[model samples]
Structures are given as structure tokens and as C-alpha cells.
Target chain A: MTRIITVALIILFIITAGCALFVPMQKPVEQDNRLFLWLPGASSVQVLSDWNDWGGSVAAGGIIDPLSGRMEKDDTGLWTIDIAGLPGGVYRYAFYVNGYKWIKDPLNPETALFDGRTVSIIMFTN
Target chain B: MSTSLITLIILIAGGTDSTDVSIIPENWVFGYDCLIDASACGDWINNHPVIDSTSVDAAVSVSAVSPEVNFLVTGAMRNDSTSHVVLRRARGVVKWPGTPWIAAGVYLNDQQPFIAGLSNPVLEWGWVDIDSTKGFGVSSGGVLGFSGDYLIQLTSGDTLSQLNVHSPWMGFAGVDYSRARIHPADSEGVDITVNVLSVRGDFRYFKPWLIVAGAEGEEGKWAVSAELRELRPIDTQWGRIEIVPGMHFAGDNIDLPGSAFVPGQRIITLGAFLESRRYFVSAGIKGMLDLSSDSLSSVSASAGMISEGGITWDVIFGYYADGDYRAYVSSTVSDSYASAGIAVEIIDDSTRVTGSASYSPRDDVCAEVSFSGDIDDSLQPECVLAVTTSLGPVMCLVGIEWEYDSSPSLRMNLTGLFK
Candidate 1:
């Protein structure tokens, strides 16, 4: 048992360090009780923000901004979308790119894998 | 009587009821004939008979039913140049047993898609033609429908008839069964079945037996059914998959030679699949382990894809491995093949045209064209025309097909309560 655990830990450590070098995690930004996300290298990114109604579009098409929102573009292919004026309630979001595929938010652990292989995020706020 | 004889008797009695039965020739009784009461106008439930029909083949069976439930069934197989035909009829399901079973089932014929054998209050006809030529001697078969208790019989050529009772106890009893019988081309032989297994519920409705189990609602789901079959001289096959816990198994008979399955090789398959509406995707593996002898083992995976409309397709690929305890032949025997096809619905109404092409690299490629039309208002009988030809060595089966459904055998007779 000890040997198995030791081997697992070593494997985990190696993967984490390798990811740090190849796929760095994104950092989100917060201001005025709102969260700002940015993704630099993405060809296209659509955001489902906290303020807009679920049916209508909050923002239709938006390109990634690298410098602001305390955002950094890592080697991995992920973008952070700035979520502003997010209320005290829970917030959910997703990204649609190239008109046909979905990718998970690397920074949000609450994101779930859709039944059909897509990704979505849910947030709980105080 | 021997055990086989007793089994045969019980099977015959299980599918019949009191009704009007008629035999073309009078004073002729090839099988058991029971007259229940006055209403049963021509109730002649014919059973086993000699096989010597050069032109037509028929079988009539009756099942026991209570006063509230009435049912009867009959089927036939015939052949001609214009097309081989299979006629079926669901005569009727009257308020009582002694009532004729004929009024309920739609009379079926090879000429067109229309309901026959019903009058007084005409009904609209509806029917879908599947593979009419594949049933009963690879050319055509016959069937009749009724509401309640019933028996099934098959007769070919002249003077040859065989009776079989499938599900004696309707849906009330959780136990059910299916019997695939074949009467040899010659009447001198005894009738036999390729597979017979108890169903978890009453999944009997003449077509698509699998759908019956699922249609009974939650009660039928999650139920397990066991079956034992002897598939040899019949050239019939069956397969299944268990995919829940994440392992798969599959096996089939490709008409291989030898005593490999003298006692019959057992094929236990386990596999599962995931599907959606517009698009359906499933992946499962099948494993064929040596049951009779450790001569061969096989594992395979099958995947299928279909669109919401337009065309639907399926693909299967697998490989086989030789068993370790082989007594003769080579050290390894494995092969992989794939099949795919598309179907298009050309006409929308009661009549439609469909075409498909399929190929297996290991086997021969084939293409098929078919048309199904219903000329009548009743759904029981339909007309189908089809031609299938091979894309290999020589075009096989460039022939055409046409079939019909017969009216159900329903007649009013003995009015009573068995209980």
C-alpha cells in the first residue's frame, strides 16, 4: 500500500511540474465585486456573464485581451473571461468557439462536463 | 406418448381457444379438432399433418381464451412467379370468445397494401412491410392476428401442417417465450426450432418481439430473460451484448465446419451503448469463448451512427483469435471486416421507396432496392417489392419480391368461463 501511494505521489508531482512548464493555469481578476477574465491566444471566445438574462445574449462576440484584468495567457489553450458585477448569487458560464466546439474553464473547478461532451461552469457567491 | 409427444400436446393446447374453424375439405382431421359451443361457426383447429403441397402451404391454430378476451391467429406461405407471397390476417377481437376472430385482423395479400376480411363497419388500413421474403422458407410467410388467446401454425405445400404455441399466458404472467419453428421442405420430417427462450413478460405482438418487452412500461424493463437454442441444420443465428459494468462479449455462427459445437457452442455476450435523438452513437465489444471445446475465442466492437432524418447507417468491426487448446489446424485465425449503408425515404404517404447498399471487406458487397405500398385502409396487409444483388463474383439475387397479409382468424363460438 505504501509503495503504491509513493508511486502515485511521484507520478502526480511529475505531471504537475510538467503542466506548470507546458500548461500554466490562468489567474482571474476581481474589481468592484466583479470578476474579470482574459484569454490572449484564443481565436474566438463567447462569454455568458453574470448580469445578462439567461435567454438573451450578454455579449455576442468578443476577442481575448491579454494585458488587463490581471490576466495572463499561459502555454495551455485556455482564456479567462472577465465577469463583472456578479451579484451575491451563484453564476454559471460557458464558451463557444469556431461555432461548433466547447472547452472548459481551466480555473473554475465547478465546471461540469456536459452529457454530450461539452463543458459548463457554475459559481456560488456570498 | 414420449416426452416429445407430451411437450407437443401441451404446446398445441396452449395456443388455441373455442371458435369457428373450417377446413377446406370436410371429414378431414389431420390434427386435434375440438368443438366448444354453438357460436364457434367453423372452428376446425387443424394440427400436425402430412407435407405434400406442390402449390400452397397453410397452418391453423387456436388458443384458449376467457369470455372477456377473444383472440385467434393464422398464417400462410405461398410462392408464384409474380412474387412469393405471405398473407396475414387479424380478423377481429370481439367482446366475447364465441365471437369470430376474423373481424379484428386485417386481411393481408401480396397484391397491395390493404385490409381484407372485415365488413359492416369498414376500418382504415395501415401497415409497414419489413422483410416478407425472409420469413418461411426464405421466400415468404403468412400471419393472422387476434386480441386474446391464440395458437400459431405453419403449413407448406399440400397436406403438410405444423402447430406451435408461443406465449400461452398473456402479459399477466411475467413469463413468456418465443419459438422459431421450421418444417422441413419435405413432410416426412419432424418440425424443429432454432431457439426457444422464456421471456420476462408477454412480449408477443407478431412483429419486433424485442419491442414488446419494452412497451409493457416499467414492469417489463430491467427484467431478464433466458433462452436455450439449438442452431444447426436451420442455419439461423442469434447474438446479444451486456454493457452495464463495462465489458463486452459477442459471437455468431458463420457456417463453419467440424464438430466444434456438437453439443452447441455457447456464446455469452456483454456490452452497452449510449444514444441520442438526432444522432445515436454506441460502442460495445463481444467475446466468444469456447464452450463446447477450447478451439476458438473472439472479441469484437461495433459502433453505429444515424441522423435524425435523411439517412441512417451502422458499422461493425471485429477480429477473432484461435483458442490455446486447439487440436488441429493453424496457430492463429483472425480477420476484420466492416459494413455500412444508407437509407432514404423517397415517398411519404402509405407508399414509400427505399434503397440501400452495404459491403463487408471480408464478405461480398450487396445493394438492395425496395418499395412498400398499402392499397387498403387496414394496416394488417401490405405489398412489398424488392431486389437485392451482390457487388461481387456474380450478382446474387437479382430477383423481385411481393407479399400480402391475411385477415385474422376470429369466429364466435362457445361462450363460457374457464375459471
Candidate 2:
């Protein structure tokens, strides 16, 4: 059982790492005024953020409009939302998937807490 | 006259320190926002609601620093149909150089509930405890490596109190535990008590957050959620790939009836994505499982890219086990002077197409026009024209909207901030 667990852990690490060793490591020049999610198999994505009162959960009777902050998906299965018009300040945002799941922006590393769930933070200075 | 005399006495009692009271504070700032919006359309539709409004609000803040205490008092006023003014924040904290401190008057209280997601029982009960309220609290330097700030407050005969204990971050880990309770004014109303502890840890490979929360009001309830997130990513030629997984579970009565909490519900979330350099090419899939129902729940998929020449393109799709689906495709391009985009969305059978364009002469100003509608023979189109500009210290947005079966709505907003 111990040997089996060790082997399983190794496989998990390799899968999570995913070919980075074979290719030269690089950092993508991520966007500051946009959000990205790679979920080609999913049907919809909405950005629920402090900026929009968590997609109006309190005002909309808990049913968030699936189209709010709707990101455009391209042929490559990546979803992107343009937020260039947002004012300069600190903001917390998360990706609401399939109407129920709350996931933070993967590309941004900064995090803050709100309503018990962890969310991604972005600060813009004009 | 005697009531006014009492106020003067109280003012004299508070000015005993070496720093004497003054008529005007040494430093002050003023900020304001003003807007006027109106809509008028040809009287074709009488049932549609139009937007017309004029609003103005301003706030003044005074800050004073002395050897014994620091004071920040703010007052705000607004005018709509009527004009009114109120004291906003009267935060006077005795700094005395650190550790234990005492604060009174209108200060901010941050007592948050430990609720996750839209499960919502917590949200209904947790709400925001009190934002700028008349209260008193005492802070302690440290006790057993944890600092504490205990506070008690009263408003409208209801008593709300909190005991917050937190450990400073040690570069890798930190924890905070808070106990808050509300005693209703009514003799028969049941009191509510909430206890929550949150721990955040930063590891070499991942960051993990754990929340354990419970509350007792009408009944006792408990909830827990764990998340392992990647704060940063290392990429390869095909770009970077990331996976985020989380789990949440709660007692059936997490909130009250009519809240977002569905009884006996549990959710497991997982997502994976890959994006190329500069995110010029990317794809991702994310989904949530309904563990209580033993069902596949809902899932979504998307892919998008921006070409090197600045043309943007994207496609998104989603599906629920209940036969509901939506798909969208769009492309857009922009330059320093002009931009345009066209897109279509299909939800079930209905389809909507949208086209938009914009022009900008300088960095601080832009004007845009857009039109969209369903293409099902019976035309229902919505059109909008808007311009944004900044004049001096104030920013402005003015727009007009004309929609089928509705009167046109016009709006203008102006905002200014100075501190």
C-alpha cells in the first residue's frame, strides 16, 4: 500500500506539472484590464466581482444573469472579458462558471477574502 | 436653551488634553459627485419606464494629529428632492504610540460572516454587521501570540458585540478567529451567535485556505470549505496550464428559507486551463458537481485569442444537464484612434447579433455607438450612443439608449474625488 501511494503521488505531481520540464519555461504577458478562463468544454462564464456586487446576487433574487460580464470564447477554448473601462482602485473578482461554481482568476496571483470565499484582487493606478 | 447647554458641557469635558480645541481643523478636504439625467422620447409607448434624475452629494473630512490622539471627522450631504446632512465618520483613536488603544464615536466595524458561495443562509444572517457605527472598542497588544480587539455596540436598543483575535502573518501562515453575537431589542427575539475561524497558508507550490464556521440562532449549524489555489504559474512553449479545485459542505439549515441555500446540497468544483504567450491563444473548461444529487451538474467550455495584429476573436459555450445551453462567438479589433466589434449569441433557439464601433481623438475622451437585437423577423432592436470625457477634476459619462417597445432613456454622470 505504501509503494502504491508513493507511485500515485508521483504521477499526480507530474500531471500537475504538465510538460513544463520538456519545454522552456516562460511567463505569459498577462493582461491587466481583462480576465481569462480556459474552459472549452463549459457552456458559459460570468465574472462575479465586488465591482458588480457579486453579479447582483442580492438584487437579482440569487439567480445571476448568465450573461453578466459574459466573456467571449474563441476557437481555442479560452474565455476573455474586457474590463478596460474600470476605474482605478482595488477590486476583487471571481469567475462564476455554469451559474454555480465560484473560481478566482487563475492568471492573477493576488488574493483577498470576501463573504467567506477567497477571491482574486487587482489594483489599478491611473 | 438648556439642551444646547448640555452639548457645550460635553464639548468642554473632551478638550482637557494639552492640545486645546480649535474652531477649525488644521487639515481638511472636500469631495463631491454631481449628475443630471433625463429621457424624453416620442410618446409612442406609455407603459415603458424612463430615466430622469438629478443628484448631488458632497463630503468634507477633517484630520487632526496630536501627541495623545488622532482624529478624523467626516460629514456628508446630499440633495435630491430634499437636502439633508449627516455626520459620516467621527473616528478618534488614541494612538499614544501603539499596542493597546481605545476608540469611540462613529468608527468602522468589520465583523464578517463565514459563509461560502451562494449557499446564502450565512449571507442572510451575516450581512454586514455595522459599517461606521457609534461604538466603543479596546485593543490589546498581545496575549499568547494573538492580538485581540473586543468591542460592544448598541443601536436602536439592539446590542451587537464581537471578540476578534488574530495572529499576525508569519510569512507562511496566519489565522483569525472572531465571535460575534446580536441581542435583539425585543424581549422574545432569539439572540444569534456566530463563531468562525479562517486559516491561510502559503506553501512553496500552492496556497491553501480553510474555513470552519458555525452559528447558533434558531438552531445550530456548521459549514466547511477548503481550497488549494495557485498564486502564480510557470509556463512552457504551449503557454501555462493551471488547475483549481475546491469543496464545500454545510448543514442543511445554513441560512433561512427563501435564501440561496438549497437543502442537502454540496458542491465540488474543478477547473483547468491553458493559455499561450500573452494569452494570444487560450482554452479552458470548468464545472461543478452536485454531490448531494449524484449528478453531473453544470459545465462550460471556452476558447479565445487575439492575433498579433490586434484582431480579437472568441467563442464560448455552456450546458446544463437540464437541456439548457448557450453559445456565443465574437471578434473585435482596436487601434489608438478607432475600434469595432461584432458578435452573436444563441441561447437555446433565440439568437441575438450585436455590432459596435467607437472613436477616440485623445486619451481622455471617447464616443461609442452600438446596436443589437434578435433576428427572428419581428425586429426588437436596442441602440445606444455614449461619450466619456474628463473635465478638470471631474469625469463624465453621457449616454442615450433607444430600445424597441420602450422609450428612449438618457443619462449623464459626473464624478470627482479629492483627498
Candidate 3:
């Protein structure tokens, strides 16, 4: 019985260690001004982070200025807010679709670890 | 003579004083130790350091402790280089039986001054009982994270042995839109279903039943535990319970009955179930009250089992006092019948084939075939085609042959400890 228990423990340790060693770790992401997104469905999506807000009704006028920290509203039916001026720390924001709903950006691929729900990240540079 | 010299050199190296420190990524708990004298420190690795957060930084306070630390680390520290600030040391024993308790510790960064602007504030450490739901944070300008390896110490205590139960607090403020067949068994017309949305919530608690067996020195003693779960969904004014059983049978050997034997709204049920071992088997009893024009009361027992091999079965049986409806039907009708049902589930996990069949002597034979499984954690869709044919002496069905619960009702409750 002692031998069996030892073997079992050894097997468990090996399995756990093997799993840990084999498990791929996530790489540190390069933070940028590209809009973070949270849209789960729907064809087109965009983000509005700490940097920018809506650019009004027109499509071309919706593009936010990078320096001015204006949120972009592109022709892709995506809604965006700007986080360019939000400082060096991490800033979270969502999407504004059809001018009424506050939602996360769908198109942005990178996500924040704080909540499992999707949110765009804006790591500002001095 | 050479071995003696080597041993002396090794001893000298081991006796040197040093400071060792390390911290895991992202979290803010840091572990460190100072060996004023290495030889005197003995085996420093033998000492366990545990840390806990009892509060977060608030507007008025610069540092505090919080009760939400949930990770453990197993690592040692050494003194590398140090000067300046005095290091105050505190030590104690923390215990958690059955499983390793999280070892908690905090090291004040002595060399670097806690400068107003440059100093990255650390969350203060505190002991928190695990029952609190509120989380702690740090003061402004302090880093929002933890460092160091979480160490789990083992202790025998009531906190580790109680059943944790949880019920979800659910609230549905929106309206429900339902569409149904206009006429019984008629597919051509559609009926407007009443709109009702439910507000849901639950309270849950969990306790661990840990088993440890062995002599003091033997590691053969292992700790394993099983958790028990009990859940109940609160009733709402909008909830409805309706079970109407009627039959119309015409054939040789089948006693003559009217075109229909209608006992509307036959029963209402309320109770909870006890599921064991990851829902492999569950036994439950529900109070069944007669709602027909007749007065009847009875108790129904239900048992459901699912095997690891993908076989599923369920049995439901009940004993009830004859109600007014049952008495009326018995006195007025000659060929009346009653029966129970058993359902069996079969699945081919690889091919994504799933099906279930139920048979009742007095009721109808119900069967459904579906293909369901997760393509990914984010999206899982199931499509089932079902049909129920009236068997026995009755060839009549009051409802449409096809019905489905479109929304996958997910009851999320806070209860029971996660193994």
C-alpha cells in the first residue's frame, strides 16, 4: 500500500509538472492606440477608449484625430472613442453602435485581464 | 586529506550571510528574507512565509489590508544586497487542514525610501476570513498588484469542513415573447403566448468534507474531499405549473371511452433535488398537488443517473390519493389507465450523435434526436428534432407534436466549493 501511494503521488507530480512545463505562456503585448474592442457579434465593430468619443453622424467625419485624442467613427459601421490623452496607465473603453448603445469594441483583438468580458486597452506613452 | 579541504570550503560558503528575494509576475505580493548570519539561519528554506491582504488603499488612508488574496506560491528568498532602512520581522504559524493553506508574508522594501511620488505604494497585509464578498484595493499612487509566491499551509479547522451552498440572485426585468400553436395538434395556426420575465437570485454556501488517513510519519495518508450541493429556485408570481393528462382511445380490446377524457391542470409540483458526484446521480422528491376539479395530493420521487460512458437514465414514479377528476373519470368511464415513464439517453461523442427515448404505458412514447457539443468554449449550439406519438389505448394528443425550449435556461448560483 505504501508503494502504491508513493507511485500514485509521483505520477500526479509528474503529470502536473509536465502540464506546467508544456503549457504555453502568453507573451507581453505591445500596447498601442489601435482601438480595443468588445463586440461579441454583428459584422462591423469599433472602440472608443479613454482617448476619444463619437465624431457625430457622418462617416468620414467620425475618424478621430490621433493627436487630438478624438475617437474614430469609420465607414466600417464601427463606433469608437479616443484614449490617446488618457495618460500612460491602462485605460478601458467600449463601443457606441447606431449612436445609442454603450458596448465593447468587437474588432480589437487584444483584451484586458481585469474582467473576462472584452474591453479595449490603451497604454499611453509620455 | 583533499576531501577534508573540500568539506571546509563548502562549509564556509554555506555560512555566508545573504538576502534572497523573488516575486511572480503581475500580482503584488513579494517574498524576501535576510540572513544576518547564514550559519545561524540554519535551513532558511524550512521556514514558511504567508501573506494576506485585509484592506485596500482608500482616499483618507495611504495603506491598508484586504481579504481577497486567493493565490499561493512556494519559493525561498535570499539576501542579495541591502543597506539603510531597518527590517522589522514578524513570524507565526498559519494552518489549513486537508489542503495546503496559503502562506502569507510581506517584506518592507528597506533600501529604497517610500518617496511621496517615486515610491510605489504596496497594499497593506491583513488576515481576512474567506467569507467576505467585497474586494480591497490600494491607495492612490500605489501599484495595484501583488508579488511573491502564494504558500498554502495546512490546518484542521471548521472553515475547511463545512458545506458551501449558493443560490443565484436573478432578476429578469424584460418581457418574454412566446408563440405557440393556435389549436391542439394543429400546425397551421399560431397562438400568442403570454409574455413573462423572471427576476432570479440565490444564496449558496459550501463546506469541505476532507478525509485524511495514515500514521503520523507515513505520507500514504492523502486528503481527498467530496462536496454536497442543494439548490432551490425561488417561486415567482409569473411562474406557472400545469400538467393536464387526457386520453381518447378507440380499438379492439380497448374499453370504450368518450372522444376525450379531459382532466385539465392536473398537478403542481415544488421541491429540490440532491445531486451526487458531478451530477452522475440525483434523487429528489416533489410535492404533487391535484389542481383538477378533483382534490388530490401525492408525492413523486425522481431519480436521474448519468454514467461516464455517456449513458443517461431517469425514473419518475408517484403515489397519490384519487382526486375528484380521477374519481369522476373512474366512475363515468370504463377503460381508464395510468402509468409512469422511464427515459434513456444514448450518445456518440465522437460523431456528435445524441438521442433520448421515453416510454410510458398510459402516456405517449417520446423520442428526440440531436447533435450537440461545444465547438469552442464561447459558442455551443444544439439542434434537436423531436416527436411524441400517443401509444396505449389513446391515439389523441392535446398539444402539438413538436415543442421546444428555445432558450437554454442557465441557472447560475453561488454555492458549493469548487474541487
Candidate 4:
């Protein structure tokens, strides 16, 4: 712990002294408050999970809402959803493609089962 | 606090200028999202089984920064007997976007947000589904390692009220407090008030959480549950192992409004899971005890493995102390363009078997077929065929299903998204 703090302090000092060139580039990580999927060819993508009642599958009439947790597509074929302002809890989510197929988040290693389907798990904090 | 006072405060906050300076917001801003979905399905059942024929749903969500606003409106129409067209799930929220941002949530379906508990949540288990009510919520933090979300909801007749305060985490375990009171809609109805508290923390190696709740002026109107989740994982040369333990106790008259929690029960559970590091194999076993009756409640075990040839097989078995049991087994094989799987399940005195296969000729299109039947002929056999494809900016699906005693069903779906 002491070593870690000392190294952090040294790096802060170097950055403050304008010699921060020694800092190394780090690998990209998954953002805590967002979800991402890359499927440029898919026409639609929605997050079907334990939250939103599995896209309302278990609601009164068992109607599957097509836009429940809908994701946005960018020019680069990436689909993303911003889950900010969500109450902190654990949620199991999977990308529902074209209204049928379920795709788990490849970047997330933790997994859980939701109604016999494998979904990605996230520990969300406000 | 009075509802009138709350309304006045929100109105006052909204009238203030929100363009004071550059916004450092992990916050809402000028944007809009919308989608429309349409589908049709028809089924002929032996008794009376036919879909409403078609359903259409659309939603629009918009946000802005200057006078901070975020709102969503959803409407749906279905074609059927009593074909009802409704504008539901509509919610409007206005934020005073800054530190300690104030916000209000008004929704027809009461999808108001709240923080319950991470593990053994006594307040909310899955989705936030409450009675029809309008709620005011206030939230702050995600700054300086402190965050809190609070909400108060009221019904029109002032017969129902709920309050929730949740602090996710401030470099440690989280805390929660919630209260709910309701007077039945009908005359001569009883009144119930429940207060709950939950605390959960994470340790680097494992996590332990607990919850306790009680209702005022009621005998045995209380419940408590605790669990040590993700506990005791040991790594070895061959694989990894983990075990979790938990227990529950509730009073005879406890009425914890949740979808899955039993109100009159004392139960204990122990579960273990193991995964092979060098091979594609995993196994799990769980046991439950009914402490109230001092008997075994149920036990279940599952195992799965994959072979070098890319063939996967899995098995699950369950046993209950009441002399009921179930067994399931399945195997699958896949290649670049196609995959096939077969499963068998034994429940009660009958066995069921199902087989399914899918072929994806290209990245844009796929077709699938499945069939299921029972060995004892008690359940009529069923078969289904479906195809999915993408057409530029739109995706489409068509499916046909048939059974022994009913006419075939045909279904089609089309979906798209927009800014």
C-alpha cells in the first residue's frame, strides 16, 4: 500500500512539474455507466434484462415492448445505452437484436441466467 | 411535507435561469430519442386462442439543459376485442441541473426510480412496479465519493404514500431506508404501513448483505433476510470453487409486497459452484432447508461440459422433500453456418423431448425450426418455424407454429429506430 501511494505521489509531482511525458497509455476499459454493442448490420438493438421486467415479458399482458432500453447507433456501427441516474443495484442485461436474438456483452466477464438465457451482469452504482 | 409545498418548490426551481455558466455535467442536455414498433399475430387454439391481430407502440423522449427537462411519452394501440388505445407510461421530469439537483417524476405506471438493496432487497426485488401514483424525486452526488437518491410518491386520494432513501456507496457498504403505507381502495379496507432498512457491503474477497423490515401495529408483521453472497472462492491448479450461504425468516402475517419473497417462511440455503480452469467443465449444487418444519426443502445440481469437437452437453437434476423431482439433459453441436441441439426433461411421471436447429447462410439472414413432444402422449406435440432477416434500416421476422389440436399460428414483426 505504501509503495502504491508513493508511486502515485511521484507521478503527481512529475505531472505538476511538467515532466509528465513518462505516463504510459492505458488500455480502453468499459465505462461503468454505459453499455455498448458493435453490430452495424443489425437494424435494431434493445436491452432485455431482469430490469424493465425483461422488456415487459412478464407484465400484465405479456407484451414485449420493442423499445424498452433502446440503444443508440453511431456512424461506426456501435450501439450504446446510457444508464445514468439508475438506482444502484445488480442487473442482468443482454442485447436483443432485431427483436429476437439475444447477445451478451463480450466485454463483461460476469454472467447470470435470466429465464434460461445467459446475460451479462453489471454492479451499477449511482 | 405537504404536496402543495412540494409543487410550489418545483415550480420555483423551474422558473430560475439555468444558464449561469459552463455546465460540467455528467447530466442531461439537448437530445431526443424515439422509436416505433408494429407487429401482427394470429393463432387458432382448440378452446379460444387468437391474438388481437396487430399491435403498435411508439415512444418519444426529449431532454434539454437550459430550463432542465427530461420527459417521455408512450402510446399503444391493439386490434382485438375491446381494442383499447391508451396513452400510458408517460412521465415528465424537470431538473435544476447542478449540485444537489432537484427532480420530480410523474408517470402513469409509477415507474418511478428508487434504490432498494443490492442483494436481499426487501423494498424492490426486480423492477420498480408500484401502484399508480405521481412521485417527486431528488438526487445528488456521483461527486466527491458521495451519492444519494430519494423519492416520495402519493396517490390521488392520499390513501397511498411511499418514501425511499438510498445511498449506494461512499467508499464502503451501502444503506437504504424505505416506508410504504396504503389504505385499500375499497370501503372497509385495512391499512398497512411497512418500514424497511437494508445494508450491504462488499469485501474484496467476498460480500455480505442483510435486510430487516417491520410493519407497525401488527403481530408477526416483520421479516428479516441475510446472505453472504459471492463468498469463499478458492483457486487451485485445476479450477476454481465458490460457495454462498443465506437464510430468511418472516412473521406469519408479514405482507412484504414483492414478487418472489415468501411472507410466512423460515428457510436456509447453501450453494456451491466449481469451474475447471484447464477444461470446459462446470458444476453447481444447491440445498435448501425449511427450518420451520425442520425438513429438507429441495436440492438441485447442474453440470455442463464441452468436448474438443465443439460438442456441448449439459445436465440438471432437482429433488424436493415432498417427493417431487425433475431431470433435464441437453446436447448441442455447431459449425460455422449451422447449429443443432436436443433436450429431454423428466418431470412428475412424464418425459418431454425437444429438438431445434438453426441455419445462418449469411450474416444478414437466418432460419430456425424446433419441435417438442411428450413421451406419455399427455401433451400434444408442437412445432415451429421462423426466419429473421435485415432489410437496410429495418429488420423483419416471420414465424409459423402448429400443434396437434389447434390451428397453426402465423406471426410477423417489423422494428426500427430513429433519432
Per-model TM-score of chain B: 0.30, 0.75, 0.20, 0.78
Model 2 regions more than 4 Å off: A1-91, A94-126, B1-52, B65-70, B99-132, B141-145, B155-157, B187-190, B217-220, B231-239, B256-262, B275-283, B294-296, B303-306, B312-315, B377-379
| Model 4 chain A poorest ten-residue lDDT run | A19-28
Distance from true position, residue B356, model 1, in Å?
Answer: 12
Q: Pick by lDDT: which candidate is best?
A: 4
- DockQ per candidate: 0.01, 0.04, 0.01, 0.05
- Residue A66 of model 1 has an lDDT of 13
Off by over 4 Å in 1: A1-126, B1-154, B157-173, B178-187, B191-197, B201-263, B276-279, B294-296, B306-315, B322-419
- Fnat, model by model in order, equals 0.00, 0.02, 0.00, 0.04
Estimate, for each residue in B185-225, the C-alpha lDDT of model 4 and write its tens digit. Answer: 66766676778777777876776767778887769888877
lDDT at B352, model 2:
98
Q: Which should have the higher lDDT, number 1 or number 4?
A: 4
What are the per-residue Cα lDDT tens digits for candidate 2 across B53-89?
A: 5665554445556644556654555664555555544
i-RMS, every candidate? 27.3, 12.3, 27.6, 11.5
What is the Cα-based TM-score of model 1? 0.26
Worst 10 residues of 2 chain A by lDDT: A19-28
